[model samples]
Structures are given as C-alpha cells and as structure tokens.
Target: MTALMKQNIRRITTVLVSSAMSAFATVQTVGNFSVLSMNTAGLPDFLQGNDVPGDKTENHRMIGAKFVEYGYDIINVQELEFKLNLGQDFNYHAALYSTASLPYRTPTSGGVPFGSGLNTLSRYSFTDTTRVKWNDCSNFGGADCLTPKGFTLVRVLLSSSPEGYAYVDVYNIHADAGVTNADLVARASNLRQLSEYIDNWSAGNAVIIAGDTNSRYTRVRDEIRILTRENGMTDPWVELIRDGVDPTEETICANPTTLSYCETVDKMFYRSSPVLNLQAIGWSYESSRFLQPNGDILSDHNPIVATFSWSLPASLRQSELYGGPHDTWFSDTGVLSRIFSPRISTIRFRGGSRLDAVSVAHVDGTSITHGGTGGRASELKLTDGETWTEAKLCLGQRNNRTGVFAIKARTSAGRTLTAGSSTEDCAEFVAPGGWGIVGFVGGSGSEIDKLGFLFAPH
Candidate 1:
C-alpha cells in the first residue's frame, strides 16, 4: 500500500480504539476550483443550412479546454454521439455515458453523421455506480418527432480518508426539449425514480444529478426543485443564485435582434446532507470572432459549469470517541449529518495524542464557536447562553487522526452539579459519515444527559 493508504489503515486502528474510548471529525473545498460544461447538440442526420450542426468531439474538446482554464475537476456533457474518441485527449480516469439512440437525420457538411446521449468526466477515481435511461421520445409525434433512448447514473466515492467514505451521484441526461409539461413530468418522475434507487443503496451519499432536460421553461425548473428539494436535495445553481452568482452567454441564436442569448437550458444540480458551498457558476459563450478568417461560432447550446465544496457534520469525532455507524444514512436522496445542539458539555472525540491538538465549542452570549479544536485545550467553552443552547466543535488539523475525547461541562458561575458529560447519558448517535452535532437543553433543572458533541472536519 502507499503512504496515504498506510496512514489510512493506521487511522482505522485508531478509530477502533477511539470508538472504544468516545468518537468524531470535512471539504470538498470550493477554492479547489472546478467546473462542468456541455452542449455540442449533435444529431445523427444531416441538414443543408446547418453550417456546424454540433460535433460531439469538437464540443468535448472545447468544454474540456474551458474546464482546464478554470481548473475544474468534473465535466457533464450533453448531445454526445458516443463515437468520439476520448482515449487520451480528455485524460479523465472515471467517465460515464449513455447510448440512448436517437433517429439519424441528415448531417451538416463536414459535420458528424449523427448520434445521441450524455457523458460525464472526472479526474478523481470512481466507485459504486448505476446508470438510468428514460423513454420520453414517444412524446414526440410523427416521423420528425424522434424520441431519445434515456439517461445514465454514475456514482463515485468522494472520500475514503482516515475519517470515512462519502459519495457523489452524477446523472447525465438529454431530455426532449421539444415538449414541455407532462413530458417534463415524465422525465422528472424518471429522475426521481433514480434518486430513490440511490437512496436505497447509499442512504447518506452526496448526489449530483445534472443534464440537458430541455426543460428551459419556468415550470420545468419548478418541477426539478420539487423533485430534489422536497427530497432533501439542494440545487447548486439556485444556491449560487442565492449567493449572487452571475450568468454568461455560451450560445447565441442568430436572429434579427442580434441580442437573442436566452434561457438557462443546460444545468448541473446536487443534493446531500453536507452544506455544498456554491463556488462558481457561469456559461461558455466566448466570441468566435478571433477563430476564423470570417467570424463563425460553433454549437447551439453553451456548456454550463458549477463548482461545489462539501461541508459535512463533525460527529465523526464523537463517533470515534464513543462509536459510530460503519455504514451511511440518508433523509431521502441526500445524506444525513448527526444533529448537534447549540449547547454542549461532553465531547466524544477520536484520535488525539499529546502531540495532537483539540479545541472545544464555545458560546459567547448570543454567539457560538462551533467547537474550535486545534493545539492544546484547557477547557472547551461556548458563547454563554442564558438559555440552554447547543454549538459545534471546531477541530482543526489534528482532525483526520484523533479519536473521540471527553469534555466536562460547567456554568460560567463555576457550578458543576448541573451537567454530566458522557456519551452514554447523552444517547450518543453517530453521524452518517463522521460529522455531526450534539443537542443540549437548558432549564431550572436542565437534563444534561442530552448534551453531546458535534464535530465537522476537513
């Protein structure tokens, strides 16, 4: 095994010992810099007036270069014919695509013959996967209305660090953008079914379901929100919009107006227990004026990119100190982190030696420290709460190693008779992976047994 692997094995041993002792620990860091893009809109048949009818390989290279510029790790592409060679040029270790056959039409001069489907690319390794296909092509009528075959699901292991194994599910789809409403509903149902499948297999796994749903209408976006959000999933784009993300033009349809860049048709969505930080989101619509002797643009749909940072619970430390689940759990399609109370007393932590550091969650009046852990600790404190409240543990570097440890609770007034810091009394519960929070309540005669530790790592 490699050095990292050896360290992982050693940590597992420590975790076993720590669980015997108490438990606890997280990032898909946004600053890592990543992007996802697509829309070569290639079709099987040829046509006369269609100058560049979107070639799958050309689109792939263009999107890949865009990602390279922005330092993106993942790319979701749509309208790929599956015939393009990705053997070495793309350089993705784990890639997934669907062969959803579509009717062959006339091809544009010098363009690809024709094909249909979606594809996903990743630089990281992938494990535990599934593929889903849809049948909405029937919605289109007559010889001109060609229905698409379906979609695909590819699940990847996000982290197998000393802390735990987390996952992310990516789905690539090219829904019939020609129709709306019921057709969109059918596609949404199909996606939901896939989500349910993942839920059954990996309960607490992070998921990213994206594609060219062709649901550019307001209703379709709403339906998507319901399918994911109602099921505990969060849309990374919507989250970015909430965080104030700006949009860029990737494709421009030539019209008399010359100002026809419209619709957020292509997209990428994610849902999970961890707080997914919306790092960057934008479309690829740079001008082609510099590329040709006579300015010419390629492709119809501009590829879209979305970057995320995973923020899971801190319960792993507690689990290590006390013992946590070897498997995972999910609320629906999203993973579930251990719940922590604003008020804390006991900290069931994992690996920690005299050389390692540990910090406690502190509460000051109305503020909370989220349990900061690093270096040595004399006593863990939270911003004082007149009312019993819960907070999180902020553990730093020593995070990945240290097992669970214990923390004694006392009033700022120096009264120790009130609370007992023990996972046994606190009803210790493990967070799905290894991050979570402890719950504490305050009263004249408060029950301190409910007080536990909530830890989140990096």
Candidate 2:
C-alpha cells in the first residue's frame, strides 16, 4: 500500500464534508514569512531516466539548490514543464531539467508557455495572475490533464512593515488524481471552480491555500471540510496539531515512501480576518535532503516545506492616549485609537482628499455605519463616499467577533485632519483565512496623515 497509497484506493466517490472539527486558534509565535509547496513528480510520465538517480538534470540542480537552502519567499510547484528553447522552464527545473527554471530557475522566461505544468517561483513581487485549466480530467490524473494541471492566483508582496505591506493571496493547486468517476468529477470541479474563482475576490485579503491536496481529511470525497468550514480555511498540519507543524525533523517521517507521509497528499492552509494572526507554524520535509547522485529520493513528491508568522496590523498600533485604544469616553481618553486586524479584504483607501472619514469601532462600541441619512450610532462611516483619493472598505463584519478594533478619524476643517489618523480604523480583523491582501501604515497624529491598504480589485 505505497506508491502514494496507490493514488487513493482506485474507486471511491462520496464528497463527504465533515472533517475540520475546530481547534487551531492559538496563533502568534514569531515569524516573518516563507512558504514552499512541491509535487515535483516531474511529469511526462516522470522521465524514468536510469529509473530514478543522478543527472535527472543533476536532480533538478539539487532541487533548485535546496529551495535556495530553504530561504523560501514563495515557491509552489507541480509536475512543471515547458520547452520552447531552454528558455523559461519550470517545475523541477522546467520538468525535470529540460531547462530554464526551478530550485531557483527564473532566467526570464516568466511568460509561461511551452508545457506549463503549474509552476510559481518567487522572491517577492507578484500580481493578479490566475490559471485553472482542467475541464474534466479523465482518470488517475489523465496524464495530468495533459499539461495545465490547474490552480494559481498570486498576490505575494510580503514585507514593508511598520504596520502594513505584507500581502499574500496565493492558491496553487493540483487536484484531480483518483477515486475514479472521472476523478470524482474532476475533483469536484477543482473544489467548485476554486471556490467560485475565489468568490469574486476581496474578503479582507491575506490567504494561502497551498497545494497538492489529492483530497483527504477523511475523504468522503475530499471536500476537505468544504475548504475548511466553507472556505474559512486553516489547516496548519491538521488544525494546529498541538503547536502545529514547525518541524525540520524530530523523527516523524510517517510514510509517503517513509519520509513523513502521514497521509501525505501535500497540504497547507491559512486564513485571516479576525484581524490578522497566524503568527507561527513551521515544517520541512525535503525528503531527507535532496540526495540522488543515484542515492535516490529527489522528486516522486516530497518537497513539503512551510514556515510563517503573521500578526502585524502595523506592528500592533497602540490605539492612542499615548499608546492608542484608550477611549476614556466623554472625559476623552485622549481620543485616538488605531486597533488593527483586517482579514476579509476588499479594502482600498488610497491617498487622501478632504480627510475626515475613517471610523469603524468594536472594542465593544460596535460600528460599521453608513446605511442612510448620516448614520453614526456606534460609529462606522469608513470613508463614506469620501472620494478622497479612493475609498472602499469591507472589513470582515459578517458576524464580527474577534477583538480590540477601532478606527477613528474625523476632523476636516476643525484642523487635525492632516496631523494623524489617516482613516484606517483601529485594527484587529483577521480570521477569514482565505481571502487576500495585507498592508498598512500607522503614524500620524490627527488630521490623518498617509494611510494605506489594497488588493481590492474586487
């Protein structure tokens, strides 16, 4: 019962939907960023060359220099291949070393053509790319939908913090391999058209689904708890398995040919909106380190690496009285909060214009106003048609209940609209775990000085 569990038993189709019971919510551990997903079977029936050993293009350049020796800014791969003229190759160095990419191959051919077996490599700088080929794959991966396996979205950015600019919105998939019946209806139409093409995008941004999920979590049909409780996403080694992932190797190489299989189909999930907070989770299963000078084990699936730490609504803005979030009521606790946490996305509040509209409260004061005739009960105008430079807010309020969040900014002609509070509502909005976008700036005294947040092409 090996060979990747014989690609999941052969024939089973149920679409279960029950798994993710609830557990992982203890975030914050200290991390900057890193992510890597691999399935480098190096397709075209895995170029059998000497039946798996050295020179599989030097084992894909030693697996792309061991993912740059595990530095990883972003790298998702699948069978990967593309051949025009040794230009821009990819996925295990462009399909098992035909050329141009992988482990660390980006000599320009990013135009992505030739064979394109789902490849994404980055050191940062990403955009709105989207690709999902599979129409209705045949069976046992139908030669992997003949070269366009499926799944990719991009977003990336990942840095520049003072309290913002750490974007992410990567999807990267590889579904549709077994359980017959046309591979369970093309893996449920690749999880319902990749959750309806990321459901029109913008939920407070910041998502990272990861890949190679040949569907598990107690199968049923590998609905995978409908993408973690209806696309709320967050698996981190199965719902934060007692301090989730974070392993370089403490011995648990569970199975997949003995290097930590444990039902390995390759997965890694993340989501935020309860105001950004997946601060830690680590992993590495480089299949016992590259090897293969004929020693073996380089790509038959076993790249699996992960590491992350997020929770920086601008490094936790202090909500001011001197340290933010004081709110002394009528007595005026200095009145200047900046709580942070936005994980639903769809935020766009560019430069600034007349200044004065930036309020969305909930440190118990509850706010999300602007329904009609100058609405403002608990406060939440959120740039009500300010047309300042640009405005649009959609913080995760579908049932708001995370913690400490305030966004006060009002003082146009009264003077101070140019001092501090650039209308980004006090922070704390993570917990959606699927959408994408994250960036911020928290410093300015009153009239709202330079504010930010984008990823809302919604």
Using lDDT, give the best candidate's number.
2
Candidate 1 to truth, TM = 0.49
In order, candidate lDDTs are: 0.40, 0.47
Candidate 1 residue-wise lDDT, 268-299, digit = tens: 66655443223334433233311222334445
- Lowest-sum lDDT 10-residue window in model 1: 441-450
Model 2 over residues 348-403: C-alpha lDDT tens digits?
12122222223333333433211112212232222322211112222111122221
RMSD (Cα, Å) of model 2: 21.8
lDDT accuracy of residue 331 in candidate 2: 12
